[model samples]
Target chain A: MANLKNNRYLKLFTSTFKLSACTFGGGFVIIPLMRKKFVQELEWIEEQEMLDLTAIAQSSPGAIAVNASILVGYHVAGVLGALVTVVGTVLPPLIIISIISLFYKAFRDNPIVSMAMAGMLCGVAAVIFDVVIDMAKVVFKKKRLLPLLVLIGAFIAVRFYAVNILIIILVCGVIGAIDTVVHEKKGAEVK
Target chain B: MIYLELFWSFFQIGLFSIGGGYAAMPLIQNQVVDVHPWLTMTQFADIMTIAEMTPGPIAINGATFVGIQVAGFPGAVIATLGCIFPSCVIVMTLAYIYYRYRGLNMVQGILAGLRPAVIAMIASAGISLLIMALYGQRSLPSDLKQFDAIALFISITAFIILRKFKPHPLWVMAGSGLAGIILYTLI
Candidate 1:
């Protein structure tokens, strides 16, 4: 950590801001760009650590973009790092969206714009479909039966029953905890 | 009143919307379109499309859009801040706990259990969005009572482009926009 130069705070803020400004699509789209910036360009973080952080960010609540920023920030400079990175990450969207909001009515009423939006929704949906496939491949790989059941159960609960998402997460978390404790006991008995 | 509601609603969304940006869509739909009377179904779709094209996360873009529509600039700030507030605190706390206890079996198990469910939620969200975009009444034709052939073509074209070249999504979206302008005008 000591190899880093002073003014690391400014560096962190600007670097994340740059990434946030440049990246187009949210979520998985930013991972490679982030690896390029933080791991390759600056050497601020190790490659393996970058992967680990990405995993943690995905699993944690909130936007992947925000979570990733916080992880990188916390890693590089601690709490201050996290704060600056969050600001950096959120600033671009705030600006762009605010500007759009000013012209919201004009954008909405224009037939040409509406047509373009219709086409864009199609494209966006397709892109999200790709994301679902990518995530499924990663999540299902080498997964055991219990985890698989949780996956299906969760989908059914949310998609059909319209169950609250937080409840599902909480229930699954508890089940996972129990699974771990039981496995530990088995291991101890065997030993 | 609207400002406070915007902040409070988005804060709830921020707290519970897990997985990623897309996972927040359904919850946002429920809050903005269903519970409150902020955006209509068509408007929600448009906001999502705009959010996709914009920089930063969709969730933030959504909050900003809804906030602005409701109460202007300050509303935008409040909603955006509220949306991100929970994330900052939660992630910071998790980052601390994660580093300390990452190797523990219990923590690992929790994540493992959670990962599959998260993936499922993402899938469910994606499918529902796709359905709404492609076949939902608002997206399709009204009198003709049929799918919009142009939109269908654009979706397939975009999917193929992404599949073959694996280009950045921005390119896919940009190409789709260009096609939309051209195709929709022509037909």
Candidate 2:
């Protein structure tokens, strides 16, 4: 039993570390890779369970990759598993960024590097724009008035009013909670 | 004290940065750029470019990069810890609750509500970045002469390619870099 537990922990750590180190494009990319590793390969988690955990990971705070790892780790081996997974997931980025940072000054000052960054900045903006459009489309597909209002209202608050981002997030969360409660009550009354 | 500050800043970013890595952009920008003045807008854009190319969450990458720029390797370690600390606590508790209760309506509702707001936040970040890329400034320039037409052309072409073809983002970034070299350097 002890050996099995140790083996599971080791596997969890290594799997996450490998995924984090190799995968690019962040959470959306990593989550599918994780599902492949844990579900199809290891059979540690069921497909449905992985899906549920993914939804939870997406909804919760922090990086979805880290959150998903924490949930999976805990599911497999409890608290210690969660700790191990989180460390594994974080290590790759930390190591890679630290190495890049060492040479950042050189890159920043090089005229060639600066021009490339300038062009890459445009690419970055395009990618961010794509994200905005994609996410907004999902919200719009629901056809809800409150969501549309919140979307426009939040954008205006941040862009023009300069309201704090933290405040905006908190207020949105509260509004969402209240909206859910009120709808649930209506459903209950009808039923 | 600086280490403490780095830790706290990234901790808050982790705690509030809901949705995902892209959604975290505005929050990261607010802290490292607006609040602390640790990085300029262009430098922040460079970090975002690097984050997209790298193999990890942008939030983690951003924290590590900013920490290194502001301090050193120790700073990078501390900032990365601060960023993931919230994930460790929040995800574990939420996972426990999820298993205990099974279906969670409140979580679903809250996510639904947040969806639009998250989109808005992402849009806000994109707009600022667009302004920076086109005008070479944090905000729009009063005079049109400050605008970089070549940058605008690159961005529009990139946006069209992304929307139409949907190639991997790496290709778009690499193409842009090559374009930059040819247009800005070689020309």
Candidate 3:
């Protein structure tokens, strides 16, 4: 809501860029880092806003980091903020990928590098696990049955039927929307 | 023509995919494997494996690797750009509207529904990863396939132990890589 240059835009942008470059696992890994810098250090955004944006970004499409940047940018200073945040987020991966590609053969099978990558993989799985658990507690509310059934359906589709993912998302979206609308109508009627 | 196709394909992936790269995995596999046939499923699986082993998001790696294979360096560039474009537009748009309607209950409620769905998708993915890791466990050939079980065990145990310890994740991964090498040579 203020002029970009005078405020903390540059600092926030650089911090996110570095996080993007360094973070191996996408989604949750980059998210906590972004929260640390934007929400915590600079106070650019609040905690609730971060959670809300995560929901929006997940549903919207595109790289989580990019969508997130746009949301944070939009929330912070409007159109210009969105532009700066995206540029900041893109710069890291763009630069790093270019460097990696240029030296691809040389680094492709380096043992130490390979070992480091192996470590990153374990960390990634753990990072994603943390995200799944934290969000599950909030969303599913420790439900005993319905959420478990939904989880079972998804696993069956992925493992047994080998169903197309888009189909799964479509079904879930429709079901979720119906549940939300019906519940809302019931609430309004009670009032 | 080639560059345009590369861009459009990833653009489509970006425009529709949510919950990040992991969620996009199945559709991406389809685009490259079934629809386009630019890469075989085996190669695609291998790419997924490598992507996991490397840095950055899964979709980005998919775009980069698939694009390079199809149309060389330029293809990778366009595809990556296409992949992130939707986020740029959508996030900025939402940010603008979110200000005026910050306290709308309906918006908040829709989010509540969507949250559970996203978690479900992540759960399914975790199961898929477990299956992949657990593959060699079931079909072990007495002594020949023991390495597979070891990796799985290390992954599971390291996952548990590392959760409590404050050491960097890279250390755990590097240790596994060493284990992979040692297992490979000795076994």
Per-model TM-score versus the true fold: 0.70, 0.64, 0.67
Candidate 3 lDDT, A1-191, residue by residue in tens = 45656465776577667766655645555665666577767898875566667656666777777777778777776677677777777666555555565565566667766554543444445545654665566545656454456556755774567676556655654665666687789989999
Docking class of 3: acceptable
| Docking class for candidate 2 | acceptable
- What does the lDDT come to for candidate 2? 0.80
Model 3 ranges off by over 4 Å:
A1-7, A25-52, A140-191, B1-52, B58-82, B94-102, B127-187
Q: Predicted candidate 2: what Cα RMSD to the true structure?
A: 6.9
Residues B1-187, model 1: lDDT tens digits? 8888998999999988887776899999999999999999988998887776567888899998998889888888899889988888988888898788868888878767777776676566556545555665433245545666887888888888877887766567667777888998999
When 1 and 2 are scored with TM-score, the better candidate is: 1
Q: Model 1's CAPRI class? A: acceptable
TM-score of candidate 2 on Cα atoms, chains taken together: 0.64
Best by lDDT: 2
Per-candidate DockQ vs. reference: 0.46, 0.43, 0.32
lDDT of 1 by residue, A1-191 (tens): 54454478888888888778755545655665576678777898865465557656776778988999999999888888999999999888889888987776576568887666667667766776665565566656765688789889999997889786778878888888999999999999999
Clashes of 3: 2
Q: Rank the candidates by TM-score, best first.
A: 1, 3, 2
**Candidate 1 recovers what fraction of true contacts?**
0.70
Q: Which pairs, if any, clash in model 2? A: none
Q: What are the lDDT scores of the predictions, listed in order? A: 0.78, 0.80, 0.64
